[model samples]
Target chain A: MEPELATPFRERAGRALDDRFLQEALTVATTKFITLRREAFAELPEGDALRDQARAIKEATLQRLDYWLERLIERIESRGGHVHYATSADEARRVVLDIARRTGARMAVKSKSMATEEIHLNDALQAAGVTPVETDLGEYIIQLAHERPSHIIAPAIHKTKGQVAELFARELGRETEPDPEVLTRIARAELRQKFLDADLGISGANFAVAETGTVVLVTNEGNGRMVTSLPRVHVAVMGVEKVIPSMTDLAVFLAILAKSATGQKLSVYTSLVNGPRRGGEPEGPEELHLVLLDNGRVRQIAGPLREALNCLRCGACLNVCPVYRQIGGHAYGYTYPGPIGILLTAMLNGPAAVKDLAHASSLCGACMDACPVRIDIPKMLIELRREVDQQGIAPWPERAVFGAFAWLLQRPRLYRLSARLGRLLQRPFVRGGRIRWLPGLFGEWTRTRDLPAVARRTFHERWAALEREARR
Target chain B: MTTKAEFFDRIRAEMARTPGRAPSALAARPVRPREGLDVLRRELSERWRENLDRFQHELERVGGVLHRVAEAGEVPDVVAQIAAERGMHRVVTWPRDTLGVDVAAPLVTRGFDAAVMPGTEVAAAERARLRGLAAAADLGVTGAEVAIAETGTLVVVSGAGRPRSTSLLPACHVAVFERDVLVESLVQMGLVLEAWHEGAEPSWRGAAINFITGPSRTADIELTLTRGVHGPKEVHAVFVERGLSVARRA
Candidate 1:
């Protein structure tokens, strides 16, 4: 039986906030990336114009995704590349494992790809008796702890230098200091051999072009390039929505992804390959495969969640999310943490299974506004919250309050009276008319900050008085 | 066939639901640029530069060399020097010229396995042959249709005359560019691309359009910089002074 790969929002949040070092590390790291990305965007000189084009390009590509995917599959197949359409995480793993078995894979190295993490490909490989090695520095650290990522862009954002020093001392089989530079050195020395020794490479798509049947990978570190080239066989696991109609489509994403991710105009390496190496190339994989995972994306594409598909995986939303700011990624308890994760988990895992994820957001529009492609994440959260409400999955006290409020709302006079009484009722708990400590149920809101105070008078009463005064 | 085979066969039959049309199948689809193409071009140009700078820093981190050239006329000579210094042969590949292929006289004279025959279709077999031909060749070269100075990335659109692998499957990738072809950013370039994609058939299959920022590099091993772990370890770009006036601008 699979040990539950779940962390209830409350449980995860409790563990996260308990660690002061993790909190500090997240603060320092997120701040640096946020600052760097902002500076880079501002430095472009031609930045604003590029953002518009990149936006248009991504939107245009998305509109014609179906058309492009057909063309892409043909081109890839024609180029001797094999493609598999997987409908779920299990299917994705099955296809990749089948390929590994066919190639007799002994070892595999991987770059950082959200889709791979979402599908938990590493575990599947380990299950199949292949040693799966993470080549990304942050990913390597988490892999050592047999833990999941705590942040979108920086996986080890929750780990302080001291904690990492301890982890390395125990995991790397050596004594190490907590110094940032020293820890980075230890991590570097370990990943080199994995790249050379790995027999197969797996990566995720940044962009897939239908016109050329090419997959694009842009990265700050060149690990993505190594994972694709060094191995005899290479497999790219992508979500179906990643397909774009043309090579030109990338121009748009290229703009927003950098600004939204690291505030750069571009990443360090943007490698586009249509198929495996053909001739005298001294290196590069001999065979290439792409597994397009649908999971639940196809349903999302034709539904209200289509806006979610517009996500470029820039991590900008994660940077600005107030809820994410407080609790961080791991608190969401899934691979995709933050505003995106809340909605994604609801759809992908279904509301009943991951209901706790719904309350994880404060409905702050920071994430939506920060999004380069403009996904209305706040609206999605509200919709999911409504689902939670309907399922009666919300807290018992809140559900009862809402139930009574619903009864009162049906009668205007009662509703007005209820509002007046509610304000009076909440006064004792309020300090300076603002609730500093809630008695029960709403404790999460009051745990760290005061809840907003309600006005003494209802708007309807004020409006009625204004009408009578006008007549006089 | 076994039970699993039967299941897959049944799945295939079901998925054969809509028989796919040719790559150009979408030719009849309305050409509605959901978002303005010109607007997209302007946005991408800035993005290109931003992407280029990021690409450059990444390459540098991995101990790769990044040289920004100012002209295209000097491309061949620069490429020749790089190859010669590396003890690669005098043979070099060139990106497509709208008017004609750009194989120099000295290169044509070489008795290699096979070179991109100047005026032939860049068919798959032909591409495979060139890969075979380029293994021992001094250098593999191609001209970048679009060069983004922001990211220092060279965009090569492979079509009938150009083979996709020529730019990537070589010992050293030599990309030639004209100063004018170098766009300030990706946003500005999207204007022309929108038009280029205007009547593009969905079934129209083109070779890969590789956007290479710098030499292939990896910082995977504990963030230690390693060059040429995979792909082309060395990438040399020559900025030719003269731009091709005949090539159709997107």
Candidate 2:
């Protein structure tokens, strides 16, 4: 059964933190991944230079994203591929559905593409009578378990091998062990024939080169290639921001994306598919359709938030994110998770809708270090919190207290009085020089984490004592 | 009818409006952006290998096989054995002079279907025939314009002698490459691809550009590593002993 997702991210992250196993697992998985990724980067020559190069390339592309997207649509169509423009998820879904219906697609195999997940392609396909099969191992496991991805890259990072084995046996209707290799073998055998039988293959593009009218797919498993190549018809769903000016530009982003995502210098298969094969060529989709989704990206592109488009969905930010490392991707309540998720959710769902998402982070700079594209996430979160506060969307008591405190902070006498009053109020709860428990509104703060007692003396008192010592 | 050409024209117009071309990152390395077949081929190989070697290990670990071939001469025999052992009889490859009719003739003599094609000839009938060929054949062999030694990546550039589908539509892709095609890093590869388009039409003759490191694979169905999900299930490389592969220096 799915847990409650209607609550705000704060409550969800709080609940997740309260679950000791989740916190431990997230820490273990992300830390190991971060270590592996770091080692991989370390092996590269002047790795920092590469990161800067990746960042510069992405930023340059984002700067002219609008123009590039237009070119991409044009190029795709020129190669006998159909291009559709979707302004919203609903539109993208409707278009995909119309295509599915037209194709008479009853079953579809998909790769681990976040954009498709963002639009909830599986849910849409299932609703339309086309059963969607996830081909990425992590995504497939989560699908079988009836769960969403916990990590951006490793979707089922939250689940143990043992849990996967049990889910497979129950869902696949075959006995299987939890061994990682065995699990992989089992999944391979089941999906191999599905590739040959499927009518259409759907994929998400990492980079769509306008120069060549090509969709660049990077993957560790060959599934990404198959999903695009095997079926008679191919449907690609991509955000407009994924475009680059030319194939030459593809080389820049490709260099850093794999290293940052999973410590892979590059994925095993990086297929650059331009339109469908022509003339006497064999084994490629007869018809190719490229779906360019604007969703909320266009709105954020020109503003101060345009930097968000620079994200490559590498999940490096997710691995190092203190908040994401705790509650995982599902808690973000958006397709993207972690630092990127926090920013994207705010932009996609609006700040008022995801006010709690900003406060979910600890604002530690770990994510910044891991971000290959160098998205200044902590600054973005703080800016978002300020936006939320300015919108007056915060809880009443919190708002009221801050409003009064703002006035008091402006006056010296009132500030002193409030400080003394605050000390007296806390005096009753002081025990063994620590405040072990708190009351009422503050109770949630100390439920699992300790709240420190205020200092016994204020700065004024400490200053006076120093003055007296100086006199002596 | 909206032919692919008109569609591409609109796309070209769109690209013309983008913030122009991106500045190279290797700006400090003295921007001697190398063009020509040798330099472009070199750059493509460099970038391809860097990406391939980095990801191919996981594919191998999961079940795919990755090999490095030193020469083109070793290709036919190696390909023949792979098909024979795997029970593959029919074969397809890009129509290139280097890959040669004689190379595939051995397999044909052994009674396997053998054919070479340019990637641009893909149509409904062609795709159907290719699928039929793949179903009946054991291996689909092609040659890469550039091969990355760092990652063992095979870069297929489609043109008159090469067909994009030959590399991707096959159940297995066996590439025969020279040792000289290898590059040390992606930076060099970036230069190559850039120069490949330095002056020509953006779309050029090739419609599809692919970088394949291993067999077609996926883990999505149930988080299992399944091979041949969309493309070839196996990727084999043939490197000649006394041919052209160059390793990068520090």
The candidate that achieves the highest TM-score relative to the unseen native structure:
2
Compose the digit string of candidate 1's lDDT tens values, residues B1-250: 1233342343344334423321211111224553555454456555654545554555454334545554344444565567667877635354344322344643444432225433344444554455456444546777666666556666766543455445544557776655445555565454435445555422222423455666554432222344443346577655443443325432
In TM-score terms, candidate 1 sits at 0.73
On lDDT, the leading prediction is: 2
Residue-level lDDT tens digits of model 2 in A102-212: 988888888779888888788888988998998887888888888888778888877777887888889988787777667777776687678778988999999887866
Question: What value of lDDT does candidate 1 attain over all alpha carbons?
Answer: 0.65
Residue-by-residue lDDT tens digits, candidate 1, A1-472: 1123454558778877887765665666566667867787676666665555555555555555655677888888977898887877888899899999999999999988889898889989999999998877778878987888867667777766677788889988868776665666565557655766688999999888786677888765557766776577999999877887764556656766867776655665676776875542334577999887777766654454656876778888887776677677766767788888777766677766456767677787878777776678988877877877898878787688878878988999888877888898897787787888886667867987887787766789899999999999
CAPRI-style docking class of model 2 based on DockQ: acceptable
* CA shift of A271, model 2, Å: 1.6
**How high is the TM-score of chain A in each model?**
0.92, 0.92
